[model samples]
Target chain A: MRRLAPAVGPLLLGLALAAACHPAVAGLLGDGGANRPLSLTRLSDLALNHLTLAASGFAFVACLGLGLGLVVTRSRFAALRGGIDTLAAFAQAVPPVVVVALALPILGFGGPPTLLALAAYGIMPALRGTVGALESVSPEAREAARAVGLTPGQVLRQVELPLAASGLIETLRTAFVLAVAVTAVGALAGASTLGTPIVAGLQNQNVVAMFQGTAAAAALAFLGDALLLAAGGLARREAA
Target chain B: MRRRIILGLAGAAVVPTLLVLLPLMHFAPNRLLTGTAIDAPSILGAMLWPLGALAAIGPGLLAGSRGRLAAAIAALACLGAFALLLAGLGHGAAAWTAGQPPAARARLAAGAWIGASLLAAAVPLGARRVDPAAGGPIGALALAASVQGLWLAGRLDALSVVVEFRARRDELAAALLDHLALALGALALAALVTGALALWRRGRGLVDLTVSGLQVVPAVALLGGLVTAASALLSAAPALRTYGLSALGTVPALVGIAAYLLLPLWRGLQGALRAPDAASLDAARALGLTPRQILTGLRLPLGASVLLGGVRVAAVQALGLATLGALVGAGGLGTLVFDGMAQFAPDLILLGALPVIALSLAAERALSGLEAAARRHWPS
Candidate 1:
């Protein structure tokens, strides 16, 4: 059960993506509007942009979470740690609509803000996992590192982090899946992503377009999840 | 002692300033405030005075031996003040009374009084009893004040304030103060409800049921449904037609979207409760407490981290979802996005999208602090 649970993300992603490309499925792409051939050019553009956004969001969140996780562990400053975590959670709780509304007047719109929101939303899982994983590292291992004259940074880098890597990777995978799923929502703000088709489909009540867009989104989410699971597995093996 | 007091006061001042005041200062309504046609300032003053009175009564309730009784009285006084203030403000009341005969005002006043009385009766009963062992009265007062501040901030119209500020930049400081108060009210209400619920239920399913159900509903679909429902209700009932509920766009859409965003927080808390260590449960049981006692005294304290963690998630989600409010005429960031889309203006879209993103990032940072605090006090 445990082993298979990890495979769900990847399996779902692959199947959905593959299904989107089938000839029988071309009817689902929604009106296709003026863009003819339903060609590989558009598909490639989407795949590339989607991947880039996902990657950027993923990388940003991972780094943010890492720094935050480290700060939380090293600093005995309870209030500071508490404050940061609360902020992150509140950020997570806020409806994406509200964030966009609140941000519109200040930051304007576009790829940057959308990416920023995705990155922000994505960080929580990884940050949380890092904290939990690091805390769970055996105290004895930490003490051994200390007794051996390892600096605190050295202890974290050489001992605690490596031991906690598997858990951290799992957390990142969850974040990645979430980011991929929500990236489509970026279309609502006009980021020129796959969600554009879906939104257009909804506005026009075009079922084919809606199906195409939804299928693409679901596929992307699944693929992203799968990739993360594979990465997590590989990391676990490396740790072992 | 002085340092601690100073620190507390600073926090009291700073939090509202950043979250509510700053936003309001940046967006206070210019036309409404500047126009001589309405007694807007006087109305506002009338509202604030009674609210201030309510705030004053809070401390006495917290301090007295008959705390529950005192709180009940204070709550009643607050409700009475709120009614008087609302009546004096006139805008909300006028809107409510529109198209209705003058005779309805008496009924409305009576209804308001009855409602206030019921709310007062409910407050003390719902108040969480302070743990006798948990430090001094100062801590309790601080908690109460914090709650009040948050409540004040959250319930305010931040968008209107921001719009006002944009139009009248000179009044930025006052606008910001008002906005802060509103945001504080919102935060306070959320905190109080979530905190109180956490204390009472301790690992129960209410949060999960509410939040997860909310999560599964897609935002667009939810908004559509809400708009449809609002239109139907308004058209079907003559009374609602006066309020213009059938008006399409931002308001209805935003309300729907906001409703949809609540699920994750609810579910997140539920998930957190389920995530706690089993050993802690056994330990509580071993201490000779009943299940109810165990939950209130032990599990709740232990689970505070997770519960709050859930809240942080919900709050961030809510912030993001609020941007979509503009689609239904609720008017927030979605207005920018939708308008940009209509006109094919990338700059406008970027303008709208950027703020949503920044707000989300900022919210994430804020919630991170809450999560950390939860972990600290309720160490796994």
Candidate 2:
């Protein structure tokens, strides 16, 4: 049972994705919206939006999180650090869906708000991880930099940041994967991301569109997570 | 040092100044009682926020640790003053429109929004070096000040969101209740599953990996899968339909929420038990405590805080995820948000979004309090 349960989830996910592509299966399940099956092009376009939003949003968030993390970790903003941490985690705890929902009014319909939501979600973990990583840096390294006549800024840039790179990279990897997953739900707000099929399918009772969308998204999420995990591992190895 | 100070001043002034100088508020004749007025900063309105921000910084830089308390006081005062001023402006706007329909209200112009956002930014900027723990209270204060400023001072009451909320008060109330129900229900379900999983300690590593893996699953896809699986089950059994089980309703939504929440609770439980205060357990055993006694009195009591922390995380998570249940027609606050969106009502979206925020934050606070209380009572 122990060996079996781990494999079961992915296997089920894969099977669902595969079944979504089958015309007869989609029909049998009453694939609701116009009873139409998603084409390869449609799936790919959705994936394209999904990837674009996730990549760009993740980049913006990671950078922002890093900066924010740096500021809060500083002696100047010391008092604000715990608040920042709680707020960030609180932001994360508030699901991407709610952010996207609130943002739509200000950002209007489409991919922008989705990207913003992804960024909001991404910032929390990135900030938390960056702080953790920077704090984990040995005091010896910090003292050594100070002894070498390095300014605080210089020490952060030259000594501490590079050493913290692996942990920071891992954080970004998590953020990137999470951003991609969150993007799929952006469809409800009118972004043609992979969630397009799923949201549409759910709305119109089209099981086929729903399954195809879910399958493609699940497959995409798994692929993105695996790639990130690999890249993070490799980066950590090199940094070490 | 001079250059650094100069750069800091520029960084602070740039955004708020542009917000003031530019068209901050856009008013339409129909949207408001009077003709469209953009950036109506009667001499004081324009100076108020910037001056308030400046006043906050001056005291902080002048005083040291002693000044921080004064600065904290100053920060709260600035936020309060700004909120009151903003509220007054909103009231004026509403009064002017009194002759016109109540729905005919002024929309937020660029200045009003950017100014407010800039003001919010200044709240943190006003803080002096103090205990980091104060961040929580300060955060609460800032949030209250800004939201109250926006709602009462800014006349968010006049917005379409409030209008929709007012119109559908019953439904909105129901949605809030529904939202709460789904969140608590899912957390309960997750607790049950995690309890079951706790028996199989050796399988924990795999469980953790699988749970984290699921965390990365796109929410839409997860919902889709649950919907499909439920439909498939109903089709196969036909008897399950009698139990309020369906592909598109509360059951599937509950399942989705439960699955999402399980990860946090299970991990929290596992981590709590893994170490179990070895010395305490040894002492308990030496004291001739029965296995059951240790399990109940020692293991459970010691693990309460850690486990509750997990529950707190899960509770917030469930609260958030429960919003998605609206997509599946499960009737939560998301339904109001989607409904508002479809009708082009921003106010309605807030009607839904605000409650979710309030509930999530409230749950976070409540659970954190419980966790703290449990720890206090437990033998350290």
Candidate 3:
């Protein structure tokens, strides 16, 4: 409670902004259509689109990053090892616009490239966290597992991985939050994500629509972040 | 065994480089070098001497002990000056040929000459000792000046470069190769810096600080804010507005992308720094080793794996964000995506998206390799 006081201001401001930009309220009161009733179908459609896009991309990023992190951390090949780090750095340095532009000709517009972009962007945190967590595991515990007649695979699964699960979860949470935030930017590539309304709103100079889109994107990000944090906390508790 | 491992590791880096380049070459236009008989040859000819000079500085500065630091500083200064000179010369020539006033042209010419002269002079002084206190201020100034010069040069008909290349498939291929080369150069520089920093106390702090600053900001919001700020400033400033420089494009987008890419790198660094336990420190100390010996012999070696992890994070993040550079007309894959959007061409979009995805996958593999090497070399 005491530590959270510092975050209160930002939290309140965000909530207020979201409320002010609520699509239902804005559509009814703003200049575009005072008479037009707020439709649930439209809202649900937007929500579904957002969820699908987020889920597919976020899952890929999480899995890829996690697996890469584990393999790199444990692998024995010298060339493969050096190559991995360099590639990761290279991937990160390449701008998202460049990535999308390069991908456009191959993946086509709409969802595929957007998903690829999101996955690439989201992988770093999860990958890094996975590596960090696994490396942080106690050598004594590993030795104990070996002494207890556990094979390498069993030791990794039942002991090392379990111990590192909390950290991995935290990494996933962070990646999820980042993915949610970036999904809105997918509108630039013709994805019907939350950014579509925002871009359209901006172009049309429709403040209400802009607010609605921005609010929705921000709210979704916040909600996603909250859920991740909760998941991380639960994982940590379980680990403890 | 160590030599063999190193050799093998070196060989692996070539595969990804080739993969990225192959596609670029396949799609490259035919007339890339056409009409370059006069200007192109001259540019290439001029570059040879400067490139030679630039190449020599690295080895020269690292030779002696007393003046080593100074030599490095001098080399950097020379590079900075040369970069500025090139930029100023390009702009001055453009402005002069555009029929600018005599006084303005003379001023630009003088500035360019002075910059070039400074660069030429600094190159020979690679043996000079650097004053540690002066290094920070000088480096900051040099970076600022270089960036400003590049920005100016880049703005002067740089769009024509993109348009020209786009007009020809061979040219586009050549340009892609050039871009990849630049990217590789940057990676090599980063690796060198990281390796050097691993050997120095001050270097570690510098690396850590750089990473921390990058990690703190959210990418999208940061981009948005910077774009807004640039637009506001440009609108307010008559001079900038006259130049037709707007924030909605390359500058802000690049800044945003760069900032986003930096976050993972910084976070990784932060983690690496804190990775080692106090117990390890105490144990190393108890073995009767001095602080310097302990750091080099135990701490650093152990920390290498973690540090590389950070490097991996940073690299991947950079690759992904680099795609976004096209949003502001920075070129690369984002250009295809945006072009597709404007024209509503899915094929064009896929063309761009496929390469980026392939690039990402390739990079992911390379980083994984590095991580494994780090683990092996710096095992707990």
lDDT of residue A49 for candidate 3: 86
* lDDT digits (tens) for residues A98-214 of candidate 2: 788777756788988898788877888789889988998999999999998999999998888888887886787677777778888788789988788887777666777776666
User: What lDDT is reached at residue B316 by model 3?
Assistant: 55
lDDT of 1 by residue, B290-358 (tens): 988976776667767777665665555555565555555555555555665565433344445545555
For candidate 2, the per-residue lDDT at B341 reads: 72
Restricting to chain A, the TM-score for each candidate equals 0.83, 0.76, 0.81
Which window of 10 residues has the lowest lDDT sum in candidate 1 chain B? B19-28
**Per-residue alpha-carbon lDDT of candidate 2 for residues B18-92, written as tens digits (9 for 90 to 100):** 545765443444421323555545423554565546533433332322346654664565465456546645554
**DockQ winner:** 2
**Residue B153 miss distance in model 1 (angstroms):** 21
Which residues of candidate 3, in runs, are more than 4 Å off?
A1-17, A23-48, A60-109, A116-128, A146-158, A201-215, B1-225, B233-245, B268-322, B329-333, B340-380
lDDT of 3 by residue, B1-380 (tens): 56544543443233223222222111111212111111212222344344334434432332322255646754674564356335433543343335533222111112222334334334433323354435434544565466575765563332222223344456345435533433344344555544555557666667666654343333444454565568559868859966767777656655565554444444554466566688988887888889889767776677677767666655555555555555434566556556655765433444455455556555664676677778877777
Angstrom error of the Cα, residue B55, model 2: value is: 8.0
Query: Could you tell which candidate, 2 or 3, scores higher by DockQ?
Result: 2
DockQ of 1: 0.14
The regions of model 1 sitting more than 4 angstroms off are A1-5, A17-23, A26-44, A75-110, A123-125, A151-154, B1-305, B328-380
User: How would you order the candidates by DockQ, starting with the best?
Assistant: 2, 1, 3
Ten residues in sequence with the least summed lDDT for candidate 2 chain A: A1-10
Q: Tell me the interface RMSD of every candidate, in Å.
A: 8.1, 3.1, 8.3
Candidate with the larger TM-score of 1 and 3: 1
